[model samples]
Target: MLYRPNPPISFTGAVLDRADHIRADADKLAELMNWRARLLRLDGLDPVIGDDGALVWGTLADAGEHDELVFLGLDESGRACFAPVSPANKGNPGPANPRLWGAMASLPAGDLATYGGARALVDWHARHRFCARCGYTTKLGKGGWQRKCVNMDCKAEHFPRVDPVTIMSVEWEGNLLLGRQPRFPAKRYSALAGFVEPGESIEEAVAREVHEEAGVRVRDVRYVACQPWPFPSSLMIGCHAYADDPAITIDKTELEDARWFTRDEVVYAMEALKTGAEDGAFIAPPPFAVAHHLLKWWIEQ
Candidate 1:
């Protein structure tokens, strides 16, 4: 069965038509890059919002001759949209202003989606400027969708990569498994997660990560929902399972703390989402995070 998350998800509902058909057609793409083309305004990966509380856009004229263009998609009016990635940000991004969160939260859904996709593509191009197979320099191709090696002998093409990660809620009796990494805010806890390694299915990854991090065995692994986390690009795969036993032996290398929370405790945090109440066992993740939605799905069960 397909997993559906309520309340929708951030970065999922993009309004642009990602006209892939034109990406490889140089002539067709050039035709779209006329005066009507729109350019997203980004400051070192952070968004630039207009006074109207929407993502600010400029024109192709703003692009510098050296700027590498990433085709975002076509806007509502079928006008082409693009983002010019500055080489200064290649493999390096600045720390966002603290208020970036608020700005992103206020953006319209479609705008947010456009920004996420554009950000991922631009960042990828910046970091992967060389052929992995031959150690030769590479240049943008396929309308920024791919990179081609300058060395004809090693013409390896590269594409944007989205690493798969497994984040899951494991249940025993009526309690849910939650953990806090060292970097997490104090008194905040969420689902256990780890990268999905090669040679494993989602079910295997969920089971393996839960065991490795919390020393707990799980069964009846199942899918829940997923989120596109574009912090350098990752796909957060959410899942649910039942614990064979609730005893947790924390892997300090991976987590600062791991424990089980009662259903009532999770219920309390969900309530805190609206009330801003901090007296609960631990602060639930923000509404936009897949972990928060996974907890919501858990309590509904």
Candidate 2:
């Protein structure tokens, strides 16, 4: 079976017999390996490896002997956490040696795609040194999985933060609504998404995002899958919603344009763009993206 990178496996959990013992005492393992340890900076994902060293990819359980490895932090619920490494890390120095700094928002996403978990987590820790409650300095603990507020009275325990977002493909008849953000590369467009607000459920967030971005009410919202969008920590909750209307009233401030396209058009765009399709045509985010996954699910349906 072709490995379908989906669900919990795509972001966390892997099938490995040995790695099940690794998590409880990761600090010891990492510390022991530190001397010969290839210190990897997965921040911003542009990795730089040393001369012909070993690198493990994916979760430790899914890892091979020669693959590069990284350590992501624990989830808020204290379960379901793992790192990511890919075939791309071969012969490349870890992220720290690469000196990558551009748009802050793009770093996490860009790094997760290119680098490993260490880079992304380290970057997250760097930005979250101050406590959200008392604005006091915090210190790393639990193998960098958490930070404790220095203030003894207000010692707030903070874990790596992940914003929950909902991105959906709204279908009406045989057409799907798609949109392009202002910051997206020219002619690039994908599914609509927005952050879940306080006191909101996932379905409500999906409906709200669709209405906010494209001015269309959505119904029959169904959970599809999720992607750990570690661009400084986001969990993208993917869904498929039925569009109640097709006419788009674009919120130009957020989206440059919004429109509906037939499945055939989407297929042609994806295929043509693969072999250098038309310049003015649309391009989807790579298949790894939840947007792409959602789009793929739409097309296949």
Q: What's the C-alpha lDDT at position 102 in model 2?
A: 26
Q: Candidate 1: worst 10 consecutive residues by lDDT? A: 91-100
lDDT of each: 0.88, 0.63
| Clash count in backbone of candidate 1 | 0
Lowest-sum lDDT 10-residue window in model 2 = 96-105
Model number with the top TM-score: 1
lDDT string for model 1 (1-301, tens) is 5657654777788899999998999999999999999999998887898899999999999987889998887888999999987878764343324466686568887888888888888888888888999999999888889999999888899998888999999999999999999988789899999889989999999999999999999999998988887776878999999997888999999999998999999999989989999899999987777898899998887
Off by over 4 Å in 2: 1-38, 42-45, 49-116, 279-281
Q: TM-score of each candidate?
A: 0.96, 0.71
lDDT of 2 at 114: 34
Among all candidates shown, the one with the greatest lDDT = 1
What lDDT tens digits, residue by residue, belong to model 2 across residues 151-259? Answer: 9989998876668989898999988889998877677888999999999999999988889888999899998878775565678888999986687899998999998
Off by over 4 Å in 1: 1-3, 92-99
